[model samples]
Target: MQYKPLIMGILNVTPDSFSDGGQYCVQAEALAHAQRMVLEGADIIDIGGESTRPGSDPVSEGEQLARVIPVIQALRCHLPSNLLLSIDTTRSAVAEAAIVAGANVVNDVSAGTDDPRMFSVAARAGVPLVLMHMQGRPKNMQDNPGYRDVVEEVLTFLVERAEAAKDSGIRPENIIIDPGIGFGKRKEDNLRLIADLRRFVATGYKVLLGASRKKFMGAICGETRPVELMGATIATTVLGVSAGVSMFRVHDVKPNRQAADVTAAVLRT
Candidate 1:
């Protein structure tokens, strides 16, 4: 089946990430998890070295590189050509090294604010760049994020960032925008973003919905563990696909792939 909403399996190589941290921090473990995701129908593998969970400290460049590059190299050598590899980072240096090591995309939660060189690296490599909107730096993003109108603000920020990336020599077609459901949003804001995802989709850029196992689900469902949120995650995947989202960044690939396939089938009729 042609995956309608491309499933980007999340592979956090950091030991302190919010979910599944330490579960795949070792090089061998990370590579094995990536291989499992690919076999489970993941179209893209997003590898991140640092923990972007709220209030997380930044990892040094050298450490981050050491964490992700080897796993990327191993996966690139092992996975088929069709499975895209994405380096989930905000640093330009990491993005460059990951691309050279065989990553096909740069998924930046900072949208280039963290590193000016990121745009040039992506442009030079000619790979797709995922620019996400975050109200503030991850360290203090969730510290009472406030907005007059969350959806409109997020949309405006993404449009401006997309244009800025285009102005910086990046191809328009190579840009993808994410509304950042939980990056700096409150529980209500995340719900609103998913409910009105069509506004982002209407921009004509490929919309990537990444509401996988976020804290908002726990707020709504009263579930504490990230793995327990799989049902909620699949629900959002189906909702995003119906709203025209082109991709989904998720932890559980098989369930999300199944959700996307069923949603695509329903929409085709």
Candidate 2:
């Protein structure tokens, strides 16, 4: 059977996210945007409360719960049951609350390093967990990001994190690994990771690519605004599908869906 990558739409309820910040901060607006993504073929809607953009400060756990819980609850009631909802946060408390409120997945950018209880929370809920490889905290991740071999280091980090998640009682099948595209990577580092995505895919776990509308794309295409990088993002999506990525976390769903479907068709043929 040919594998078609799943598209996970990004819905950030934060007011300071590098892209689409404050656009869906309101509960009604967030729900409407999520519905639109679902109609556009998003298999999962990832709702993030805190801004993890470079140099961005972390939102407190209480604020994160306030920002994301209502949105998750509303989504569960309104969205189709088959469509999954992911809680994008590093705090175990926030992950736990979002799960109870109806999110089916936990996406931790810190990969359970920042919060000692994160793995346990995901295990307790028995939900799929996305562990990402970020070099440092978002506050300073981009300050001096350096790597001897970006692809090797990230792959090692992700494999180790996956092992940690399994040891913490998270089912191996329920774990997904993300390369953390712009979280702490140089432009070249981001390119290398995408180019070498097969290495990550070969780890025998699901691989997620989250390179949608990042600063590095803008750097590559000479576009300053995040929204203008959709074309660049689509290119990466095509590459990801060819590289056997299991999923894509993207801001624009429809175009990526079309791209992935076409890529999968070609691969099948």
**TM-score of every prediction relative to native:** 0.98, 0.99
Q: How does model 1 fare in lDDT? A: 0.93
CA lDDT of every candidate:
0.93, 0.94
Q: For residues 33-73, what per-residue lDDT tens digits would candidate 2 score against the true structure?
A: 99999999999999999999999998899999999999999
Which TM-score value belongs to model 1?
A: 0.98
Residue by residue across 23-101, what tens digits does model 1's lDDT show?
9988888888889999999999999999999999999999999999999999999889878999999999999999999
Candidate 1 wrong stretches, greater than 4 Å: 1-3
Total clashes in model 1, counting residue pairs 3 or more apart in sequence or in different chains:
0
Judged by TM-score, which candidate is best?
Answer: 2
